[model samples]
Target chain A: MNLLLQLFLSFFQIGLFSIGGGYAAMPLIQAQTVEIHKWLTPLEFADLVTIAEMTPGPIAINSATFVGMRVAGISGVLVATFGNVLPSVIIMLIFAKLYERYSEQTLMKHVLEGVRPTVVAAIFTAGLSLLNLAVGSISALDLFALAVFVAAFLFANSKKITLSPITLLLFGALGGIGWEALGF
Target chain B: MSGKPAIDLKFYLKLFWTTFTLSLFTFGGGFVIVSLMRKKMVDQYGWINDEEMMDFITIAQSSPGPIAVNASLMVGYHLAGIPGALISTLGTILPPMIILTFVSIGYQAVAENTWIKAAFHGMRAVVAAIVLQVTWALFKSLAEKKNILPLVLFAAAFVALFVFKVNIMVVMVAMILLSVVLSIHETKKENMS
Candidate 1:
């Protein structure tokens, strides 16, 4: 198969089966890019994960773009990203249509009623996992992280002080630099 | 509520710009994007109400692919049909596609920088905090409905994930079935009465 064709097919498969979102898609990405195609070394793959986490947009897009650029070039980037996003766009279009049509029906409402709470639970779990990553562990809690978490939480929940997400993220980056400067 | 506002060129541009900036700033993965979208789409633009946003999220999360892209598609379609969905999705993927292409050129520098690491550390904490706030808001909305079943399902879902470590897809499927069955039983009881 052509390299661009290969990239498309691999990412198309990745996007189709990546039902649980970005993090869940990581292993499949690693297997295809690292083990199967040898498009990226293991170390490069690890770095890709970090870069994906730090950069904007979803990890799947990041991974696809990175690997595609590595393998081909700008064309590779377009092909790979389109492959990854195509599955999602198609799937979501059908879902959006169905949801708009039936969302008002009682059965659909009850299904949403059940699913909504689980979504909340999933978000809560994601928060806890991120917290664990930030603090390292409860035994050796990072006080700086705890303080930042508390302050950001308060700011977010406050009525009088409204800050955009970007503003909050900038403040966080500054706090990190200050902590590093203080050598703590 | 009133019908969706007219889909003019300005509306299309706003849709593009909204998802564009949201995609550019969304770090720390899927849940982080959700928080930002809630703030921009629901709180700021008033494009969708809180309940509708929740429904969009539910569908997005449950569907395939990245939650951010999926959610953007739904929101776009809701506001302005297929063209809106395509435009919003284009905005959503462009940042990562462009940034990662450049980053792929010199990622070693980025991956090894201590200051960058420290900054991400701090950002991670804030990301967690933002998601926590969103979770609380969702919980509060569910509580406001004055129903115990959803509350019970919430707890059950938590325990299943936190304790038993069940896969999220499995838990989601189980909950949907349970909810549908309960809805049927309630309707039958109402009919009998």
Candidate 2:
């Protein structure tokens, strides 16, 4: 198959398998782009991952766009993005019955109770991995990230000021720019 | 309270309308959608509740698609008929598809814009923060019960990803093994008791 076809097929499979949201799609996405298809270098994949996290849409959508752009330019972007989304569209349309039947199933409830923690663990792992990469082998910024993390943590628990995530993001970005300018 | 009348076309139309509009405003991800869906459907429309919503989330996650899409299908199927499911799913996804289409078209024009990039830089932190918050919430739910098996599996999965650099399939296999073993142990303990 052509690269475009492969990207489409692979991401379609991703869409088919990914449940919960785009974030749940990350492990498979990273594997396909970085390891399986070699569509992106690990560094590039990491960068793409960061970009996806930052973007407004779904992470799966963002990854599809990035990988598509990388592999086949604009055409690649369209194919992959569509491929990623198509499965959701098709499956939801066809298998709507499953959605109805399974929503109230007892087995599903138990399984989800089991899976929830694991999913949480996986996401936490993803966040930590991102932190590791963002700080590039862990120095003061690692600690700084941790402090910011704790602040967010405590604030969330205390129900204090509903600190806009946007504000924290601005501060982090300014800090990054300042450090770079200061040659840190 | 008097027993409410059974469903009607107007109810279906309202469900479809609410879900579609909700999709347009959902910026971050399904997390944002969760709260919004709760507010609109449960609080506003009295369609569902906290427990039912939790069930919706669980079912959506266990299924094979995006949670938003899955939720739409389920919610729509519940509200209306098969046609309702189709319409609701379409309504939920159509906006995002249209917006992304425009994004792909003009991607290059704005790709290098400084303000866009700066705003994105801010958004990244928000993503991380929100994801972390959700993860923490899940963690508390799981750990509160003190299920040693899942806790072990959680730690093992993390180590597998972080230390051994094992593949996700490997991690998944380990998780399955851990779950099966725990189930067997639980059975054995029950027999003993």
Candidate 3:
């Protein structure tokens, strides 16, 4: 298969199969991009994940664009992004139409009520899996990193920065630099 | 322009620009963007009300694909139908594409630097903590809702994903089936009373 086509198909499958939103799509992405396709090394993946977090947008879209660009440059980015986004556009549009047309029908309401809790659970599981991966790998986790993690978590929850992702990541960069300077 | 009821170019541009600006800067995920969008699009501009935003958020969350795109699609559709959906999605994707294009091209140069490596190391571990915190917040909010089924389902979903390593599609399909069944049963019980 062509590399660009492969990139498109991979992300198309990813977007289509990514139930319960982007974070929940992480496992499948890892399986395809790293395990099956070897498009990236595990270490490269970790760095990409960091970049995704540090940058704006969801990890799935960010990774797809990054990987595609790495594979085939500008056209690759367009293909990968379109493939990743296609499913959401189609599905959400259909959903929006249906929902507007039939919101009062008890079935839709009940289905949604049931689905809501399930989604909450999935988000939790996604977060746990991310943490689990972090714990299992990464030999001798630095104490400075751990402190930064705690502080970041606190700052994230405390809403002290007035909700700026750049500000949050700037804190990470500066804090990390200081920690590295201290040899932690 | 005053009497023209149909939305024009200015409205489309505003929709595109609002989503473009929001997604270009916000991080974490769709959830973060959604909150910021609500503050701007909902509270500031009144493009959509709170309940509409909530509905869009829920649908966006439950559907397949990136929550960010799904969200922008839903909102755009609500505001201006199909064209709105396309334009909004275009806006949501542009920033990531542009940013990642440059990063992927230039990453090789910076990846080898010692300080950059150290910064990434610290950033990676901190990223984990941030995820854990999001999970904790999710759990607390869900718990506060006092929904037993979700709590139980949460455990079941975790075990299925972590312990069993089940395919997520399978888990989700099963959940949808289970939810429909439970809803039917609840309806029946209500009818009987």
Candidate 4:
């Protein structure tokens, strides 16, 4: 299959199905791009995902562009990005008005309320898949990462201190820099 | 042009420029924006403060639509009105849009490199920790309500997806249907009494 076509179709599917946002899209995006297609290494994909999270726009959009660029080139990026965004853009443009009109209806309200928790579930799925991809085949580093995970988790859960993602990222980067400097 | 001068084209332009420039650098999505917006707007430009930025971020995430994009839009709109909103949105979107477009073009060849592979390995591990953190935060937020329904739904959904290998879409639809049935039944019960 043409690479551009593949990029387009894959990203289109990603955006169409993402439902909750970039976080929700992570698992499927990883499966399709990394596991099935081998378009990107798990790490490269992870890096791009981080960059996407850091940069503006949606994560799915950021991922689509990264994956698309990797596969096809500039034109490929355009196709893939368009594919990812097209679904949401078209849906918002077409349905926003209609949704607003009937948004107050009881059934619609209840249905959306039901779907909200599912969004969180979907996000959890994405987060776990990302964790698996990141911690692969390395016991010590994985354990260290796990320690950080437990620390961050307990800190947030028990202390309610909120170690924001940015804080963890800075600390992780500092750890990396420190390791590099130590030459261990 | 306005009498009060509290709101004007210059203020709108400044807001637009700030959002556009900040949007260019922020990738991934919500969390990155929190830091970057804090740095550029709060620290550098002094458009907002720590508390205001935090408030804006919380509001942006809770409201409908993409959090970063919405934040830019709301901030822009707040500063300058409709025009400010348009310019800010455009500014926020333009950088990543352009960079991603370029990157997508040559990403395949780039993905195959060796060092890229090694770096990504470490990066992925770090990202996993970050992701875990994201989930834990969400769970904590929801947990406080003591809503067993949501927790049950969460656990059930996880099992359906991981253990049963049931399709997520199918599970989502099932949950939605269940919620509707429950709502209707409750309404009917209330009416009968």
Candidate 5:
């Protein structure tokens, strides 16, 4: 019972305070779930990040669902997902209603502009922190993982290769399975 | 609202079903689903014009939440109303909820298997890579504009977050306040000039 409340209130705070969409929310989510609640360790949080990507819909939805289920089962899924999305639902509803009226306001424009770079920085920090965990704690700088990372990173950023993210994730999984199966 | 079909059962069902399929299939981040939505809402149906679509995208992209959810809500509301928004949101979120439910339930058994463990280890790397890719794209977007404010803020934020280990929310709040001040100051200077 208390667990459900904790999940709801924590995610609600993360969702309400979070800006710049799902990816941008990673840092805050990590802090709330990993640092504050101790729901999962850093390495576990990294896995959650991967799972969030593998699933569909919003990053926040996937993540909150995963964390919720981990904490409280199906009901946990319901609470966490709702808690995280409640803000988006309400705010988006308001925006949907008044988009034309307030979108062009100077105050709004400045806030949006201000948020973009902060989001980027947060994303970078999250990625760096995750990578640091893999190197410093989880694995000993596995070449296969690094190779997969470089490949997927380039594929996503480069226009020429044109492979989908699922394909990239599939290949990464395959590479891991094969490497480990071979006793390497 | 201004130039679309009337709210009807068919419209609601179509909106719900289309987003359901898209959410079910779309893997990875919000960007992929967002593109599919543009195709469905703008190119295929012609429900919203290009300008209106662009507005929705801009506003949705910049707002809080997942890009797909935000975009769907905007499109759904534009097409119908509150109910439309709810249906579209349900469509977008339901698929993942079902899929992740299976994952969350079965994940413990899967995690214990060695081969699956290896695969997940690699998948972990991929997650980091995706974040790096997103970071690169975000930085590039700011670079293209050559705006001093964002660049400065980005540097300040990076330091505050990574080096000093400050709370991310604090840094973001400071940046928002700074931008608001800068904008107001610029407007004042322009008026004086």
Candidate 6:
């Protein structure tokens, strides 16, 4: 298979099957990029994961762009990103159309009602995992992280503060640097 | 819906710009972008209400792709049309593409930076916090409905995922089927009355 075509097909399959979101897609991405296709080495894949986490956008898009660039430069980036996004565009458009058409129906309303709670639960779980990853264990809790979490949560919920997500993220970065400077 | 906004170039640009900026700063993952999107689309712009946003999110999560991109497509389509969807999707992707291009070039330097790692460490906590806030908000909204099913489903789903480690796809399908059955039962009861 041609390299670009291979990249496109691999990512397109990833896009099609990545059902639960970015985190769920990680193993699949790893398998294709590192093990199966050998597009990236294991060390490079790990670095890509870190970069993906630290950077903006979802992990899928970030990895696709990074791996694509490594494989084939700018054109690779475009092809892979496009492949990853194509399924999303198609699936979402269909869903959007169906939702618009059937949203008023009682059955559809109930279905949404049922799904919304699960979505909440999923988000909660994602948050917990992230917290666990960041803070490590309860016994060895990072006080700095805990404090930032508390402060950020407070600021986010406070009506008077009007803090945006970007500001909060910046604050997090600054706090980290400040903590490190203070020898913590 | 009445008073629908015209699908004009200005509207498309606004949609593009909104997703672009959101994508640019969105750390963590799909959920983080969602919270910011709610703030921008629902709170700041008044483009969509909380209920609609929640629906968009549910659909985005259930769809096959990045939730952020899926969400952008849904929102853009909802507000404008196909063209809006295309533009917003473009906006959501461009930032990551641009950033990663640079990062790929400087992979060694970035991968080895302690300061960057420290910043990310701090940012992770904030990301978790932001997600917690969003979860709470969604939970509160479901609570306000005064319905037991959603509440129960929420608890059950949480347990299923966190405790038992069931696959998400399985949980989603089961919940959808259960919802459909429950709705049918309710409809029958109403008809009887």
Q: Decide which is better by TM-score, 2 or 6.
A: 2
The candidate that achieves the highest TM-score relative to the unseen native structure: 5
**DockQ of every candidate:** 0.44, 0.33, 0.53, 0.31, 0.65, 0.46
Chain B TM-score of candidate 6 stands at 0.57
lDDT of 4 by residue, B1-193 (tens): 1122255667767776777777665555666775787787667766656665665564444333455655666555545555665677667666777776655554545656654444444445556666766677767766778888888887888787667766665776687679779879877887899
Backbone clashes in model 5, listed as residue pairs: none
- Show the lowest summed lDDT stretch of 10 residues, model 1 chain A: A100-109
lDDT for B56 (candidate 4): 57
Pairs with backbone N, CA or C atoms under 3 Å apart (clashes), candidate 6: none
Residue B173 miss distance in model 5 (angstroms): 2.1
Expressed as tens digits, the lDDT of each residue in B1-193 for candidate 6 is 2234677878888888989999998776898899899998888888888889998998887667899999989888888888878898999999999999899988745755878667777777777777678778778998998879778988999999789877555676787788789889988898899
**lDDT scores of the candidates, listed in order:** 0.79, 0.63, 0.75, 0.63, 0.80, 0.79
Model 3 pairs in collision: none
Residue A85 accuracy (lDDT) in model 6: 90
Candidate order (DockQ)? 5, 3, 6, 1, 2, 4
True-structure Cα RMSD, model 3? 4.0
What does candidate 2 score on TM? 0.70
Candidate 2's C-alpha runs over 4 A off are A16-22, A38-57, A69-104, A138-159, A177-184, B1-17, B38-58, B79-83, B98-137, B173-193
TM of chain B, each: 0.56, 0.65, 0.76, 0.63, 0.85, 0.57
Model 2 achieves a DockQ score of 0.33
TM-score sort, best first:
5, 3, 2, 4, 6, 1
- Two-way TM-score contest, 2 vs 4, winner: 2
Off by over 4 Å in 3: A17-22, A101-141, A150-171, A182-184, B1-11, B35-58, B145-148, B188-193
lDDT of 6 by residue, A1-184 (tens): 8999989988887787566676656645765787678988654664465567568988888988988998998899999999999999887877776786643356756766676777677767766766676677899998888989989889988889977666887898888878877777
Model 3, B63-87: lDDT tens digits are 7788888888988888888998899
**Candidate 6 chain B least-lDDT 10 residues:** B1-10
**How do the residues A116-152 of candidate 2 rate in per-residue lDDT, one tens digit apiece?**
5556667777666554544336434554445545555
Candidate with maximal lDDT: 5
Q: Each model's TM-score, in the order given?
A: 0.62, 0.70, 0.79, 0.68, 0.89, 0.64
Superposed by TM-score, candidate 2 places the C-alpha of residue B55 at a distance from the truth, in angstroms, of: 5.3
